[model samples]
Structure formats: structure tokens, C-alpha cells
Target chain A: MTSKQKFLYFIYLHRTGLSVTGLSLALLLFPLIEDNPYTLGLTNLIAINALVVLGLNLFIGYAGQISLGHAAFFGMGAYGSAIATVTLGMPPWLAMVIVAILVALVALLIAVPILRLSGHYLAMATLGLNFVMYTVLLQWDEVTGGPSGFSGIPYLSIGDVQFDDEFRLHYLLWSFVMVSLMLCLNLVRSGVGRGLSAVAGDEVAAQALGVNTRNAKIKVFILSAVLASLAGSLFAHCYSFVSPDSFGIFTSTDMVIMVVVGGMGSIWGSLFGAALITLLPEWVDMFETYKDFVHGGILVLVLMFLPQGLVTGLIDTIKIKLALRRRKNVAS
Target chain B: MLRLENVSKNFGGLPALSEVTFTVPKGQLTALIGPNGAGKSTLINCMTGVIEPSSGQIFFQQQQIASLPAYKISRLGISRTFQNLKIFPRLTVLENILTGLTSEGGDSMLMAMLRLPYLRHRERSLKLRALEALDRFGLADKANWPAEVLAYGDKKRVELARATVGKPQLILLDEPVAGLNAEETATVAEQLRLLRSAGHTMLLVEHDMDLVMEIADQVVVLDSGKCIATGTPDEVRCNPLVLEAYLGRMGATA
Candidate 1:
């Protein structure tokens, strides 16, 4: 093979490594190329959503569990950090860590009962969880600021560096996404990942093959919730505010749509889905007013045409086309 | 290697398996033969901890395992294949085999994420073993293909490869070659002989009488949820109860 061909072959062999390297380079250079704060802010939001989607994909796509209430976990993270840093005077970094742990514990507590359910029932239970959380954020006026939403949250900073602007925060948030993407990619190739895939494919067969389906589901659920919580914290800090409106049932549904549109079992698909959905409103003026209609339309279209999710389906099509072309060349 | 005593399973008021007892000796191929609805599947399910027997004791290597969950029983070196194929359709064939290896020496989800050198080494070794398993079943070339795309006979071979990849103490094959064509059946029969000669204890539930008669060291015949006969193949073949309930007048004419 020529050098270019050899390089492509290497990428095919080590796709995860290529993804990590490519993402790192993009995150580092994208801000330099586009020095617009408006674009930077949207990209930062994409990174935050991508973080949550990566973890959610592990639960939904790999472990075969459903959680439609991730918005609640995201809310818990944001509010948890907001309360700790603003009201209780805790450090922002410390607050983020503590809230993430608390969210994980909460997920573990409810996972046993909620994950016992599958199909539409599981989806409904999680949706109900999002409703309960939204209600609490609205009704608990004493702490959460009620309908007005929580504000005055400060920016996150390291020892000497502060992520005070969109440009600076892009690095902070995308770094989280990059690391999480790497870990998730590593996980899906691991034995535990195989176990998750087994459960997703056939839970009974997975059990027979010695995969602890129940435990695997619960672990991935907690992991997914914790990531959503972390992303929520980052979201709160980036905007310097917390709001019930952002963590409603609609956001949860939108997140699920992102996973479905990205491709269920593909790790890279998570980032693709998050970016596409996050940018949709910016690209189309009609998106906000018809958000539900557009989201539903995209979902229906994707399901009908690309049932395996956009990225995976596209890749499969390209592969088939390439193979057919190669066969024709050999025949001639 | 496995012993079931007075194992009876009831669904609602009806009994599927009643007072069924048999022993699968170590390093022996035990063919479980019976007519339709004779409770052979139920007996396999009970032994593998898929379902709880209403009243019975199941011992594996002299330890009571009747109440253990399927995964725990699998961890105890017992593995099984489903009567209907349960291949992980989306996973690659190699990954399907790797799933079987996870019951032993597998890392936790957290440990896997860390990607430590030792864990990477372990993963590489495990992949090698999975590839070797695929080679054994003539599926090494298709290791990267999604299992759902494989032909029916190839899917069955994948299931067999998955079951044996873990090197379990006892393998309960629900119906290894049930729907296979003659060529596939002969290939599977050869694989069984290879597994047997390698000293793996197997409890095969199959309807292919010739495969069983050729490879089985012992045969246990069940009729209507009861053990009708158990002995060497020659002995079970001559038993009038087995001939009547399963082998029928065909064996008598032969």
C-alpha cells in the first residue's frame, strides 16, 4: 500500500486512537479559527451535551437500559453545584465533585426498581422522574428561586486559570468531552463492554454466558447519570445561572432523540448527535417555535431511513458501496 | 458432573417436569432424548438455573446450586446454549465469543475504563483466545462480521463457539444441530466428537438420533416429565420403555 493508503489502514485499525487525537486537535484549534463568541458558546454547549450523550449511549445503546429522566440528573448536578457554591460557599470544583457523587448515589438508589422495567414502561418511569424533578425545581422556591430560576452562580476556575469567557470555557468543557469519549471508547472494547453488548443483544443469553445483566445495567445507569450531572454542573457554570426550564421533560426527550439520530451503539455517534441537535436551532430560524415538530420530524425520518442511527448507517452504506466498486474493478 | 434429584417444575396448576431425575457423569456425553413436550428442555433449564424447580435438589460437583441465578451458575463453570439461537445480533462474532470469557478473569467496568497496561495485556490475550475459538468453528475469517448477518447454520456454529469459548466444566446444549442440513449436521457431529475426545462433559439435548447414538457415552430417555430410562446407549436402546415412548416401532423394526 502507498503511504496514504497505509495511514488510512492504520486509522481503520485504531479508530478510537484516531478519534481522541482528532478531537484534541479540533478542540485546540477551532477557537483560533473562529474567534466569534456566539459560535464558541454554541460549540461549548455542544461539548456539554456530547458529554452526557456519550454516557447515555452506553446505557441505552450498549447495556440495553432506558432512562428518559436524565434531565433530572442534569438538573440535580446544576442545582447541586449552584446551591453548594453560591449558598453554602463551597468551592466550585469541590461542589461539582460532591454533586456528581450525590447524583451517582441517587441513580444507584432508584436504578434497582426503575431498571427492572424494560421497553415503554422504563421510559415512562424515567419521564415521570423528570416531571418530579421539574416540579421540585419550580415549587421549592425557598432554595431554588422557584419559577424565576437560580442565578448568581460563579465561574469555575483552576488554581490560577479561570474559565471566565466562552472561548476559555470551550477548552474546559471539550476536554471533559474528550476524556469521556476516550474512556467510553475504551470501555466498549473491554470485557465489561462485551458483557453490556451481550445484554443488549440478548439478556437471557448474556446471563447464560455469565454476564450479570442486572448489575451491568445498574452500573451503566449510574455512570450515565453521573455524566449528565457533571455536564449540568458545567452548563450552570458556563452560563453563570441555573434554571428549571433547561432541565424539563423536553430536554430529556431531546437528549434521547440525539442518541437515536447519532446511532445507538456507536461511541463517536454520540458526539455527532449532540453537535447536530445543539446546532439545529442556530441554523434554522423556525427551529425554536417548532422545536417539537422539527425534533419529531427528524426522529421519524431518521428512524424510517436510518434505523441504525445516521453515522452507523452512513458508514455501512459507504462500506457496501466501496466493496461493490472493488469487486467491479477486480472483475474488469 | 451434574445431578438432579426429584426435580419437578409446575406452571400454574400444570406440571411440566415431575419427579425427573438423572445424573450427567463427568467427561461423558449424555444424550437427553424424548418426544415433544417430554420435559427435556425443562430439565436443561432447571439444571442451568434458568428456572427454579418447584421441589428438587440440583448438585454440580457435589454443591447444591438449585437456587443460584443463571449468571452465578455460569460463573460456577456451567454454561448453556438456547434451544432457539440467542446470538447477540449486533455484536461481532469475536465479541460474542468474548462475552463467554467474561464469566472468569474479567475486569470490572471501572477497571476497563482505566486502560491500565495489565488490563490491556489481559484484553489482548482474551481476544487471541476468542479468535482461536472462532477458528475451531471455521468462523475465524468472519470474526469481525456482525453475528446477525451470518447464515443460519453459521449462527448455530457461533453459538457453539460461544458456549465452548469459556471452557466451562459442563455445557448444556439445548439443540446444537436441530435445524442443520445434512452437511452441517455431519460437521457439527465431528465437532462434538472433537469436544468429547478433548474430555469436555456435555449434556446434549437433540432430536438427531444418529448423532446421539454415534457420539453419546450414555443416554437418558424422558417421557411425560419422568425419567423413563438411563444407561449406556446399547442398554437404553433395548429398554422397552424407551422404545415405546421415544424410539418407538422404528427401533423394533431396525
Candidate 2:
């Protein structure tokens, strides 16, 4: 492949590489180890969360829409998958498909009204929606198990093959994460990406240029919600149990922090953000008491000194300095 | 051809455009001239469907279009530049012009998403077209530069390049030379004449009377949402009603 093609291929493999390499290294180093299941499962969970965050970044980072209630959509997916399996007696694989579609439809319904709002109004409206969803999950005991959440969720399987163990489920989740990340990268680099940027830059200019800005925003919002829901479903089946706490405002905040700390509008940034935020707490176990304070301080530093987020800001500064040096050389 | 009939716009109780009517012929440059608060911008906004008139009908190509959205109006072979420069700042100069090619089949969201062969071919052709448009406005060298980095006069020209890139049947230029220097104004006038010669119809709203007189085939004078005079530039310049409207209130010479 040409250098450009090689570069793009490298970017595509970067996220999936981390998961595969990490898993392989762990296996090779600790061939006789038996107590590593928790760490392996948690790593898979972080990768899955990164997939969902990638979707959110496409909608919020590229499309410039605020969605604080993405967790509600995530909850819907988990519940939808569980009910499809338990109530309808469907296969877990089929349940996932049904749940994804159901969540997409729900997102469409919610986006139609909420996407009309802009800025802080839209943020507050989505926040209110998450609160409403929490109330419903708390009161709806028949299906959601009220505060206890759902249990006995079936294992995901393809035909005769079942992902029943942590090792098998890690591969499955990583495969989906790779696919999701690739889809997101393609989306943001396409014409829709330009349309989203135009909408974010200036709505009136976008409209005058014949872009259906409202429709574009709503579509991205729904797409993001659907992806989040898919991740939630996988997460539920991974543990064979899911509670209201699994998909709540705190979950949404975690995703937001991932997107923000990594970089707002970059796909790779989302992955970077997810990995760091997810793995940092585990690695910093000694400083457990000051975890929140440290994370908050990192956020403040990123906002104050690197407002464009880590990756983009660094790239821009390098480009600027290089251009200046070239100009100076030419002049001299 | 375009026609506006009995257009009336009211902001609360105050009238912005009241019963304004005019017809612009095909392949002719028509100038809309008026003093401040004379409803010139309001009339352009009404025609472009930016802000709907309180009551009115706008016809373009013998079809009613006042109720259509601004983007739809643009897609129907009518493009316009803003009084305030509205070029996409972060985009390059070429991309700004490419944005104007909205009706082209190659740049659809689906094609862009899939990155189809046809989309790549169209994008290449669009770059060529954008270059031609920029060259016409003497901005070919700056095609790769971010639009935010351009000077004010160059930015105005970029906006014009963007508006005219679609090869629209009619282009509404709002104050195309409002803040331009003499040389820039002359360049814009020359570009407009070239556009006219190339069979593009233009409706210009300009405060530069000299530039208007140099190129206008017909001049329509508006005062407080009413047409004061409609004639050739020379004839309108000599009309007593236009003189009264311009000098009677301001105590200045025409």
C-alpha cells in the first residue's frame, strides 16, 4: 500500500490492536495464572464503553449537539435485549438486533422534539429525559426488576457457538468494538461530516447552502443512541445481570469525560480517552481517596491549557510551529 | 425572471416593507437602491425567504416561491450573498465555493458516507469548477488558504465566488461593494459585468451609486418599502421623485 493508505490502515487497526495486544501479552506472561478473569473482563468492558463513546463523539463532537441522556438510550437497549430474550424466548443474538432497532426508534421519537433546542437548552432537556427514564426504570418492576435490575439474561450465541466465558466474550466484544470504531471513522470523514461541521459552524449558512441541518442533527442523534444501546445490550449479556445503575446519569458522565479528556472531535481521541479514564482508577489504586479530585484537576488542565483537547491541540501547535520555521528559513 | 407582488412586512406595529412590487427581467442587471431604513435588506430577506413577509407572493420562473425555505429557494436556481460576510471560516476558499454546489448530484450525504468512485470523481470536478470561479474573481492564488485568514475585501469576494459558483439563473448581491476600496470596487464592477456578459442575471443592492450607474440596466428606487422610481440608471438619476426621496429628507445633492 502507498504511505497514505498505510497510514489510514494503521489508524483503523490502532484501537483493536490495543485490545488484542493487551490480551495476548497477558496470556503469554501469565500462562498459568487463574485470577486474571476480573482484569480481562474489565478490559473488555472498557473497550465496549469506548465503542459507545465513539458514537457519542460523532454526534456531539462532530454534529455539535449536547446529549446528557444517552444513558437512557443505553438502558433502553439493555432492557430491550433482556425482555426480548426472557419474555419472547428469542435467541440472544436476535434479541440484540431487536433491542438496537427499538432503541433507534425511541431515539428518533425523542430527538424530533429535543433536537429543536440549541446549546444549554438542549443539554438541560436531555438531562430531564435521563431523570424521567430513571424514574420509569425505578417504578417498572415487572420487566426491569425495579431497582434490582434484570437477571438471568441469556448468553449471546451465534448458531451452535456460544460466548459463555470471559475469554470468549472478550473476543466477541473486541470484534464489535473494532467494527463500531471503523463505522464511526468512515462517517466523520464523509460528506455527512462536512454537513455536520457546517451546522456546527453556522446554522444559517448551512441552511442557505441547502443542508437540512435539523434532519442531519436528528439522524446523528438517533444513530449515536442506537450504538450506545447496542453496547449496553452486550454489557448486560456479558455479566448475565444488569441493574439501573449500569446505565444511569453517572454512566453518561463517564462517557462524556472520556470524549472530553481524550479529545472532543477525534475518533482516535475517543479511544484514548476511554482507555485512560477507564484504566487510570485501577492503576492508581494507591491514590483512591483523591481519585475524583485528580480526575477533576485533569479536566480543568485540559480545558484551560489544551482547550482543543489533547490530540488536536498538539497537532495544531506542531503544524503552526513547523509553518513558522519554514517561513523563517525561506526569508533567511 | 422574478416578481414580487404586494409584499408587506410588519415588525409588531411598524412596517418594514409595505406593498412593494417589482419585476426583474431575465439576463439584465437590476439595482435596488435606497437610503438607510429604506427596507432594502428587508425586501431581499423577504425575497430569499429568510424572514417571511406578513403577506406577499414571490414568483420565480413563473412559480410561486415565497413560502419555500431559503435553501429550497437556492436549489431552485436562485442564490444570494449576505450583507454581512457569511463565508464558512474554518473551511478553505475552495471548499467555500464547493459548498455552493449543493444541487450537484456527486456531493450527496450517501455518496460521501460510502466514498464511492463517483463521489471522488465529482469532488475532483468540483475542485476544478471552484478554481475557475476563484480565478474569475482574481482569488486563484488563495484557494488553499483558510477563509478566516483573508482580508475583508478578499473575504467579500470569496462570498461572491461562493454565491455565483452554482451558475444560478439569478444571484442577489447584498451590498457587494459596501466596504470595498476604490480598486476593489472597480474589480467587483468588472466581475459583475463579466458575469452579465456570460448570461447570468444579477439583482444588486448597492450604496455605491457610481458603480450602480456603471453597470445597471435598470434601477429601482425604494424608500420606506415603496417604489419611488423605476427606469434606466440615467433616467432614475434625473427623476424628481428620486431626487426628492434622496435630497428632500437629507438636504443633500443627488
Candidate 3:
């Protein structure tokens, strides 16, 4: 095969690799051409948000577990890292790793009881959990600084190089996003991923086929919680701020909405959903007063027509159309 | 070999299966036949650890497996199919079979996420076995298609292929040929016979008396959670109690 043909074949073999590479290139070029700090900041937020949603999507979308309290875990990461550095006297970079381990344990303990619930019960339980976390963040004045919010989160530095520049911070965030995206891509094709999908499809059937559904559910839950907490840690370091209002119950609900709007089980849906949700406010700014109304209306349309979420729905439709056209060609 | 000793399951004071005792000899097929509420499903559930028996011990290869979890019991070499057809609808045909056969090395999260050497080794072996299974079931052509899109009989065959591929010592086939046409039912019966000839123990819970008579080395009859008869097909056919139970139920319904 020609080099072009060989490259095309390679793309076909590693489609997610292709998409991630293309995305990285686009993200790299996006800020250089358009040097608006505000737009760059928004893109950075999109990457961060996309990271959290990827875990949330794996939990709800692939594992079929409902989580409405991921914001609590996210807050834990932010506060955990902040407290570790500010009070515990840990290194700024080491604090993220330390806080991640602490948050993962907390998530495991919480998930034991939370995962016992099914469907709407699980949603309600997580919703209540986010409220409790919000209340705690507001009430804990000494450590978290109460309603005024926690501040002075140190910038993450590599050796002597501080990520103080906006472009550099953006790159730092995307690096994590890229790792998370590739990790998720590998997970979908992995054995554990198949087991999770099997459990999601039917718990009894999965168990019959030797999949430990309970363990699978718990593992996915812990993984999701850890990701949310990691995102929180990144958020704190990314913006140098932490607030109870930022990790409210609505934020938890928003995470679920992102997964649903993206596609329930599609791996690429996380990026698509996060990007849409993050950029949507700017788009709706065109209709300044009726922003919420326009946003609600557009979301309703997306759901009404694409119940499986945009990414999977589009693919399914294309496959069906292609099959129909093939049959028509054969018939003619 | 597998044996169930005095296995009893009760739900809210109602007995689903009471004191059911039986043995499935190695490499032989035992047909468990019953009426609508004969507790055949409940028995299957107990054997496969879907439910803990209210009382009794289950022995597989002389090891008591009654208290084990369902998945653990499955790992201990018991596989089953659902009467309602519990195929994963969203997964493709090949994936469904791969799910059954991929339990060996790919189950570790770290191994899979890192694409470790062992995971690749398992994947390659599993793909070979999965392809072999599909070819055996004449499903190679439909391997890439989603299980939901398959015809009802084809889906049933896929479920059977999934249950039988994982090298389980004993397979519980709950109404394997239910909802199948005459030819399709014959094909499934032939497949069961092939499995038996290969020295795989099978506990077939089926209502098709003709199919049962054709393939069953031993037959056990159940009515109202009680095992009323156990013998060769001819012996069971001649048993007064078996005739009375079937004829009496039919007469009452008529």
C-alpha cells in the first residue's frame, strides 16, 4: 500500500487514537490563532469538565449506575488537595496524589451503601449526598473558609517550571484530558469494560456468565468517584479557588445531563457533551434574555429526536441508512 | 458429576421446590421435565446459585457449592441459559460469546487498561474460541450483527452457543428450544446430543416430551415442587404416577 493508504489503514485500526490526535492538534491550534484569554479560559474549562464527565459517563452510561452526587467527590478533591497543602504542609504537587487516594477511599466507603440502590433511588441518594457535601463545605469555616470560599491553592509546578501562563495551563489540562480519554478508550475494549456493559445490560445474565456484577458495579463507581475528585483537585489548582456553591446539587445534575445529552454509553460522547454544555452558554448569549428558554428548548429537541444521545444516535442512523442503500443497490 | 441433596426453597411459607434430590452422572444428559408450576425453574435457580436454597446442600465434584455466590458457582464450572432468553441485546453476536469465554485473563482491570502481554494473549485465544463457537452454531455470517437484530431462533442458538463454549462441566439449559419451529428445535436437539456425545453433562429443563424422549439418558418428572418419577424414558412413560399426573392435569384443564 502507498504511505497514504497505509496511514488510512492505521487510522481505521486505531480510530480513537485518530480522534484523540486530531482533537489534540485542533486544541493546540485553537488558542494560537485566536488569542482571547476569555475564550482560552473557556476551552480550558471544557477540557476539565470533559474529564469529570468521562468518568461520570463510564459509571452511568456504560455500567448503568446512576450518580447524582459526583460533585461531592469533585469538591472533596478540591478541598482535600487544598487542605493537604495549606494545613498538612504537604508539597503542592504531592497534594493532588495524596488527596486522590484519600478521596478514592471515601468514595469506596460511600459507594458501598449508594450502589445498593437502583434507578431513581440511586439518583435521589446521590442528590442528597451532594447537598450534604455542600452544607459541610459551607459550615466548615476553619478549613474551607465557609461561604466566602477557600483560596490560595498553589500553582502546580514541574521541577522549576511553574504552569502560570494561560497557554501552558491550558496545555497541562489537555494533557490530563488526553490521558483520561485514551484510558477510557482502552477500557471500552478491555475485558472489564465488557463485563461492565454486560452487567449494565442485565445483572442476572452477567452473573450467570461468571461476571461479579456487584464487584463490577463497585469498581466502576469508585473509578468514577476518583475521576470526579481528581477533576476537583485540578479545578482548585486550575483556578486557585474553591467554593461550596460551585459543587452544589445542580452541578451533580448537570453532570448527568451531560452524559445523557452526549449518549448513554458512547465513549466519544463525554467530549461531545462536555464541549456542547461548556460552549452552549456562550452560544445562547446571542439571545441574552431568553438564554435559559432557548437552552431548554434546544436540549428538549436533542432528547426528543436523539434519545440514545447525539453521538450514538448519529452513528446508528448512518449505519441503518448505509445498509438500506446497499440493499437498494443490490435490488436495482 | 453433580448432586443435589434435599434442596428446598421456600418463599413466604410457600414451597417452590421441596426436598429435591437428584444426581447428574458425569458426561450424561439428564432431562428434568415438569408442568407449569413444577419448580423446574426454581430447581435450576438453586443449582446455578441464583437463589440460596432455604435448606439443603449442593455438591459439584464432591465440593459443596450451595452457599457460594452465583458468579462463584458459575466459575466452579456451572453455566446456564434463561428460559426467557437472557442474551445481551446491545452486544454483537461475537461479543456475547466472547463475554462467556473471556473470563480467564481479561477480567483484571489493570491488565486490560494497560494492554498487558497476558491480556493480549487471552484476547487472541478467546477470539479463536469465539470464532470456533460461532462457526459451530453457523453464526459466523452474523458475527458482527447485534444480537437484538437476530431472528428469535438464531438468538436462542447464540445463547446456547454462549452457555456451552466456556467449558462448563455441566450446563443448565432452561427450555432451550422454546418458541422454536420444528426444524429449529431439531437443530437444537442435535446440538445437545453433540454436547452429550462430547462427554459434557447437561441438565435440560424442557417441556417438549418428544425431544426429551429422543435424547434423555435419564428422565425426572416434577409436579408441584416434588420429584414424582425418575427412570429411563420408557420406565417413566410406563409409570402409573407419571401418567396420572399428566392425564389428570390435562383432564382437569379440558
Candidate 4:
């Protein structure tokens, strides 16, 4: 192939790697520019939540599956690690790996029948699942501290290189964040991604296109659950605490809202969404009593104006305008 | 290459098709013509496994496929276009065709995440094939455009490209030119003829009698899901039973 053709092919393979690179660069640079412990801690939390939201996006955003009980997977990961370490006496890192696998298997089992549902039925199914997970976490206090929450979780360390410092933790979280983003980006343009998009657009038509719609939905759901599990493990380690309240139906709904406000189906858009939803509350703290009102108003306005979330809507606008300009140029 | 035996479909105690049997010969173009509610779409659905027949067997390449789902049937070298456009509206035109290409490594997330050489190799080959399909449909320049923005006729062409991009053993076209002008219909007809000449077996469910007669080597007529007539275009054209079924609207509609 000629140089131009080779360049085009590269883009066809990656669908433009510029955004992924930009995200990596900004994530790496954010802490260096700030350096404060509070900012770093907040950054780590954003990364953690973004990680969970990333998993949610895989199901809700990319594959067009509705999940309202993602926090159950998140909670399971947290509690899964706690039980593995405190009860089983396994190492922290080993607990993390095992929890992820366990959660994925559970998700696969749960998804088989649930994935068969469409539209509101699927949403309701997931919503009920969250309640079941939360109830188990509360009543089964023998391991989960009886809804009061669990503490004394061991800090994660890798020999001499400990993730103890706030700055190190921020780096650690972003490291996983960047890797997850890379994997997601690659998957989005891959066959699985297109298949998910196809399933989302029209299940019947996607099936007609030779896409196994239910199987595709189940695979993506398992992946997102695994991702949420990983994030849950990290969340427990980050605070050195675990709780049922942290992984409840409300959090599950919040994750869905983040996926929507971030831009459904856009990985880059989710990052912006995670940052906005996480930081926006802090930014509005001055209102104290009026915070909820202000925060909700701002979100409503953003949706009313941008509609498709900020990043995706902006990108689409630019693309449409560019196309129109090209046509105008040709005509004039 | 495709055969249906004793096919019957009933929706909630109402029979849509009953004991419909037909054969589409290998390496030839066959047109299925019927009036409104003649169960043409239902038959297409049965042939492509979109909906299971109430009773009967569908054979493709001499294998029973009536039990298979739509996706499995397509993977087994049977593909179809919808009476209404079913193109992935948000996807780029090229992506729509690429979705049908069925590259091996892409089906697995790990292979995709690692960007394995084999997956890359498949993508490169698939991209070229998709671009070639776009070119054949006169859609090369519009390959990057979202399919929803294409003109109606162009969307039909895109659907055709998507169906045949997999190089299936049989292509099922349901109302391929229902909403197109004469010029657009001519363009699509020419494209179908090209596929037929290229040795691709096609089963077309269409309404335009003129185009059907012009292109189909043989024609099958259905009324309320029963095979009313099956013969060459000339033979079916002169059949008194076929004319009477038209209910006096026959004229040039034949």
C-alpha cells in the first residue's frame, strides 16, 4: 500500500488514537501540576469511580444494556476482597484477582436469563438485583459488619513500592484507569464493539446481520461486572474501609446517570462525565443547603442544551458542521 | 439452493401462512411476488429464520435450518435485507458493511484488546473488502457518512451491500425497491443483476412486477402464504389463475 493508504488503514484500525493519547497525557499531568494531598485524594476517587463507571459504560453505553444493579458487583468486589483477606487470610493482591474472577462468574450466571429481556424489563431486573445484593450485604453481617460497614482492610503494597502515599495512590489509580481506557478504546472499534452497537441500535436487525445479540449482551455484561469488581477492590483498598451503604441501589443509579451525562457509547465522554459528576458536587459545596438544587439544575440545563452529553454532542456538532462546509465549498 | 417444505405460520390463532412450499434453484435469481398481506414478509422471515415456521422444514445447502436463529442462519451462509431499511443508522457506511465481514479475532475481547497481528490482518482485509463493496454500490465517497443521512435509495443500496458483504450462499431481499423512484429502482435492479451474473443465488421479495419480470429467471406467486404459482416469467405471466388472483388489478401489474 502507498503511504497515504497505510495511514488511512492505521486510522481504520484505531479509529483515531488521538483521544486516548490525550486522556493518558492529561491524567499523568494532572497530579504533577496540583501536588496537594486533597487534590490527589480527590483525583484518586475520581479515577476509582470512573473505573466503575467504565464497566457500567461497557454494558449501558456500548452494548446498550440497562444495568441498575452495577453497585452490587462493586459491593461484591469490596466485600469479596474483605472476606478473602480477613476470613481466608489470603494476600491482598491475590484477593483482588480472585474477587474479580468470582464476580465475573457470578455476573455470567446472572446475565444468561436477564440478558434475554429488552427495554424496561431489563432495567427493572437489574434494579431488583441491586436490592438483593444490598440485602445480602446487610443481613449477612457475620462478614460484612451487619450494615455498619467493614473496616481494618489491609493496605495494598507490592514489596518496597507501596501504594501508601496519596500521590502514589493517585498514580496507581490512573495507571489502571489508563489501561482500562486503552482496552475499552480498542474494544469499541473491534468486532465486539460494533456488534454491541449493532445490538443496541436494533436487536432484531443486529441478529439479521449475523450478530448473536443475546450472547453479545451477556459477554459485555460480564466484562463490565468484572471491571466494576476490579474498581470495587480498589475502592476498598483506597479508603481502607468497606461498607454496604457505599455499594447500594443509589450508587448504581448514579453510575447510570454518569454514563448518560458523560455521553452514551463514548469512552472518552465517560471520563468527562466521571470528572463532572464527581467534582461538580464539590464545586457546589458552597451552597450547602442549596447544593442539591443547584447541582440538579445545572445537570438539567446541560442535558437540555447538549442533549447527547457534552463530549459526544460537541464532537457530532463539529463533524456535521464540517460536512456542511465541505458541501458549501464545493457548491460555491 | 434453498427449499421450504410445508411451511406454516400462525400469529395468535390467526393463520398468516399455511402449507407454503417453494424452491429457489441454485445459482439463479428468483422473485417472490404477492399482494398486501400475501405473507411474503412472513415467508422471508421463515427462510432466514427470523421467525420460526409454525410447521415445516427450511433447507439451505441441503441442511435443515428451520430450527436455527437469524444470526446462526446468516453465519451459515444465509443473509437477508429487511422490507424496511435495517441498516445500522448510527454507524458509518463502511462500518455497516464491515459488521457483516465476520473477522475471526474480533469476536473475542482479549484478541481485540491485545491488537494481535492476526486480528489486525483480518481488519485490513475486511476494510479493503468493505471499501470494495461501497465502491460497487457507488457509495465509496460516502463510506464515512452515517447511514441514516443517506438518501432513501442509497440506504437500500447500503443494506444490499451489508447483506452480500458476507458473501453468503443465498441473499434474501424483502421489498428491496419498495420506496424508490424508477431511476433508483433501475440502479438497484442493475446491482442485483450484477450479483446474479457473478453467480450469487438471490431470493427477492419485491412488488414491482416490471422489475421482477425483467430480472428474475423464475417467479413464485403467493396468496395468503400458499404458493399460488411457480414457473418462468412468461409462463406465470400467461397463467389465468395468477391473473384472477390479481383481482382485476392485473393489467401491466403482471
Report the backbone clash tally of model 4: 1
lDDT of 2 by residue, B1-254 (tens): 99989999999999988888889999999999998999999999888878889998999999998888877887788888888988876566777777777556334444565666766676678778989999988888778666766779989999899889888999999999988899999988998999999999999999888999899999999998888888999899888998888735544743
Model 1: residues with Cα > 4 Å off, grouped in runs = A1-9, A316-332, B249-254
Which lDDT tens digits does candidate 4 get at residues A34-67?
A: 9999988888888988998887887887787789
Candidate whose lDDT is highest: 1
Ranking 1 against 2 by lDDT, winner: 1
lDDT of 2 by residue, A186-259 (tens): 55545567667667777777767766788889888888888888988888888788888877776787777777
Model 3 misplaced stretches (Cα beyond 4 Å): A1-10, A286-304, A320-332, B247-254
The alpha-carbon deviation from the true structure for residue B145 of candidate 1, after best TM-score superposition, in angstroms, is: 1.6
Using TM-score as the measure, the top candidate is 1
lDDT of 1 by residue, B104-187 (tens): 536488888878888889888888999999999998877877676677999999999999998889989898998899999999
Which TM-score values does chain B get in all models?
0.96, 0.95, 0.96, 0.96
Question: Estimated TM-score per prediction?
Answer: 0.96, 0.87, 0.94, 0.94
* Proportion of native contacts kept per candidate: 0.69, 0.33, 0.53, 0.52
Better of 2 and 4 by TM-score: 4
User: TM-score for model 4?
Assistant: 0.94
Residue B158 of model 3 has an lDDT of 94
**Ranking by lDDT, best first?**
1, 3, 4, 2
Model 4, runs deviating above 4 Å: A1-22, A286-307, A324-332, B103-105, B252-254
